[model samples]
Target: MRSPVLGAAALFAVVVLSLATASHGALQYGFYKGKCGTKDVETIIQGVVRQRFFSDTKIVAALLRMQFHDCFVRGCDASILLDGPSTEKTALPNFSVFGYDLIDRAKAAVEAACPGVVSCADIIIAATRDAVALAGGLKYQVQLGRRDGMISQASLVNLPAPTITVPQSIQTFRAKGLSTSDMVLLLGGHTVGITRCSVIKDRLYNFRGTGKPDPTLNPNFLQLLRSFACPKIGGDNNMVFLDDPSSSLKVDNSFYKQLLQNKGVLQIDQALALDPATKPIVQQLAANPTQFLTQFNQAMVKLGAVQVLTGTQGQIRKNCRRTN
Candidate 1:
């Protein structure tokens, strides 16, 4: 597990998060402050996430990806948390989604301190923010005040596939009210995750049914990838870092830098540097590390507001998996 953020980084993490307002001023920083009566809600959440982060640094990637999966389909609601046969969590896209248990633990901690005070949706956001900072990304604050969603259906899952082209992904994100720039910054989270060979096997073995590797893959990287993952005969599920090996587990601009080298693991990943429309943005982000982290922070906040339920619009679930 990645060690706990320490030294100046921990202090920087505590630096007062900026107050951000949602449409009509629904959400703001510290939304849970004092709501639990002397129990710092975010701090409690941070403690739980920090513990989880210590034991399983993978939670950093899991929680970050969980936020995207939960938000994109149902607008930042915890609909993805509902328990049932046909629920969103049962979808193929969410089959490998982790951190549900982590979120449950965090919610239980909050409930023990102050029952029904914090929203599962807010927990997801806060936990993700904490995870990002632990993984060496920016320590940005997320706006709160969201309520749990009332619906979650596998049929409702429409997340973009890993093979989606740049144009297709641009439209997909646009449909969620995210701009092209936001999509690029958000995808930057690839800086600290992994994808199995099973997910990209076709690109390595057969390109467009031609029985050849993806033309976009650099010849050298192709050999490196085959050696690292996707062996000729077995272990189809072997893990491969999304970013290059040097900075795979750390959140940095290296993912973008690798893209410039034609070393992206996912098709959409490499496409960012190869596509005319997005290549410039990729180059810009690759060159300026600070800008990448800063915009990535803002993009996450934007993602949290997609189609949220606030005020009395949705009930606060005593259990995130079911309605109260």
Candidate 2:
């Protein structure tokens, strides 16, 4: 049999190749070296994230989701952090995305130590890395130098819907220059966080208006889910853990294992196992938690680098919620 070590090395190669093609040249490991004061910016961001994680463990997942939301809509420019009645944060899909206040707090700490040095966009990325680390995920380095965008338009927030199919999800990721493997790996972020029963109720009842649960769902698990206190309609805020309830707060490869068992909470997640293109990758991740974590880190690094504003493209906003 082929060695698992070799398998992982090969997978890492694929990740590097996918990232090398798209990463901008401006991002570097120590982009803030001389700009920030003696206090390392990454250290300040991590300190705040770690402290917040103690008060609310869910903040880790929220920060991760926040990074994804920001990157997907406007290329990781802190656009999702913008404040206004019509900004991206006010978009319907982003209604539940929290952690903006946490970002602000971390930004304030950074500004006190090194004013006008680090960008809120980079702070968001650093906070994401720290949050993942505190939540049991393996650590990975993030390239810096991303500048904050000056605009946040709700009309531009075009992320894929929860009901989308695997093909549709693949296309959505591809539009952002991510590959099939990247899509599967990044979607594993679902391993953390909670979802509202209302967001997933349609899959459990009246799937496609047929008054039947989705056949893809494991029957036993479906019955268990149906028994939850969530109402049949309009209980959008009734939340359920995303992963195995026992380890919902931890970040690992349990999501792939859940997908293998037809316990995925979202239609797109179940579609990962049902679709041939993504199924094998899902299976591999389920079997090798280390490989899953490794790829997840790589995918996140690549995600942070997507269409990022760099150099003279965007400015460092004093306030994340405004352009300044």
Candidate 3:
């Protein structure tokens, strides 16, 4: 355990993708260092995340997923936090996204110390980074200075589907200026989360309309899912861990290991291990859990910098749910 943990911590040093990590023009490692006067804004956010995590262990996954969904659409902005009849929060892909109240809580705490100083966009990134550390993930320095976006429309949401192919996922992430390696590392976030049974039943019962389980699914794993996690009918919304049950709650390479075993609950998860283009990366990460743990931090850092609004491009919202 000690060796593996140390390895993951060193994973960040192994990556040299300067292009993906160049980040936005105005973003910096500690962009908010002196902005809050006497208070450390990130420290404030971390405290909120720690408290919520103690009460809701599942908040780990929710916040992690929140980062992906929020960043993927509209470029790491708090656009996903905007509230309206037609905001991105109302989008179909974001229907299951949680950790909203957690962000709100963190934003409120920061606002109390420095009114209208911290952007909700930065809060989302900071809070999610804190949650990842609390959930056994390597804590990475999240770039700050991201301003909250003024627009968030459901029509603007185009999150990739659960059934997306490995190639398609690579393209999708590439469109956002992320690399294939980044795609593999980012998808690896699923190592700590669970998917609703409704999201994976198609692979279990009628894969490709063949009226049979997906051929790649491990027989034992398939039986386990059908028995209790997901059934042929009903139980559409039941929770099922994305990784093996024993280690689903941990942030490690278990998800990639499970992929090697044909136990991936989602098509995309299994596809990484089986796809020609991504299999090597998956094999490397799976064989070296530490790499998955460590590089994941760098991948997330790159994620936080995606097409972000900086300087005077956006406003600092007093309330994350609306434009200020």
Candidate 4:
């Protein structure tokens, strides 16, 4: 028979282990089944997205990008939804990002239905899945159970810049626990968004301070972009499609096709086709839209899983814009 002292010590160890696991709970697909009155959170979110932003492709694109930006900076904790004079939204890289109002609207709907149960973080993940599906992209599953973070600092927003080289982009994504292939696949998210002229002005007129356009960009495409995208030096806020003109509103492989043809709009985008390490993936994605979408959906799932705060580690903020 075991000693009474040994039995008590073993019991203490088991309790401690259980507490640790609960405090770091793993995420699941149906995280809020019984806790809320709904077994289908995806359908509920899809209804809201379709009713409000139906066929409004820009808003759909914004919603998708919102989740990407949120995951990149702070592990998809909904820190991007917070507002302040010095929050992540005020950061230079995120200054022009839209869709906070949409996120707030989605959160309000979720709160009304299941007050104090669903998190703003999980709402973002669900909303993004619905948005992409509504945009004619492949539907994929998103694991939930994320918790809202209490902190959002502009100083901590460190997204990759538009002008970064392929090697630099790889390093940036790798620092976030993503691989080079993941970097290429996640970038396909740009397929449905717009790019501001300010982001490409240097490449258009002053590549490396030479006072000349970037030699890598196709000359004919350069003339076309100059004709409309930036007629003047200070058209900083003017915007253009990031993908081929025909499919800017559709999430497809055309962005890679443009790069292969030397029509890529951003320096970082063109660098993918120009570098040996990433060129093959870019070429493969260009020729295989189905494969691109498949890998993109997979990469996004991985993106959402980064450094997440789960279990009892964080709070479910009643207001997404402020910590509860």
Q: Could you give me the TM-score of model 1 versus the true structure?
A: 0.92
TM-scores of the models, in the given order?
0.92, 0.93, 0.93, 0.90
Candidate that beats the other on lDDT, 2 or 3, i.e. the better one = 2
Instruction: Report every candidate's CA lDDT.
Output: 0.85, 0.86, 0.85, 0.80
Write the residue-wise lDDT of candidate 3 on 1-324 in tens digits: 333324445543544444335546788767777888979988999999999989987888888888899899889888999999999988888888898998898988998998988998898888888888887887877778888899889998889898899889989999999888889888898888888899999889999999988999999999999998887879998999998888877788888899999988889989988988888788888898667867888788889889899989999999999987
Q: Name model 3 segments beyond 4 Å from true.
A: 1-23
Task: Summing lDDT over every window of 10 consecutive residues in candidate 4, give the lowest-scoring window.
Answer: 1-10
| RMSD per model, one decimal | 6.0, 3.0, 4.0, 10.4
lDDT of 3 at 127: 87
- Name the regions of candidate 1 deviating beyond 4 angstroms: 1-25
| Per-residue lDDT of model 2, residues 1-324, tens digit only | 543333655867675666533445689876777677577888889999999999999998798889999999869899999899999988988987999889999999999998877899999999999999898999877889999998898999888888988888888999998888888888889888788888888889889999999999999889888887356756667888878887788989999999999998888888998898888888888998888888788788889989999989889889888988
Per lDDT, the best of the predicted structures is 2
Q: Which whole-number lDDT from 0 to 100 does residue 224 have in model 2?
A: 82
For model 2, what is the error of residue 52's alpha carbon versus the real structure, in angstroms, after optimal superposition? 0.4
- What is the lDDT, from 0 to 100, of the residue 73 in candidate 2? 85
Candidate 2 displacement at residue 250 in angstroms: 0.6
- Model 4, global lDDT: 0.80
Could you give me the TM-score of model 4 versus the true structure?
0.90
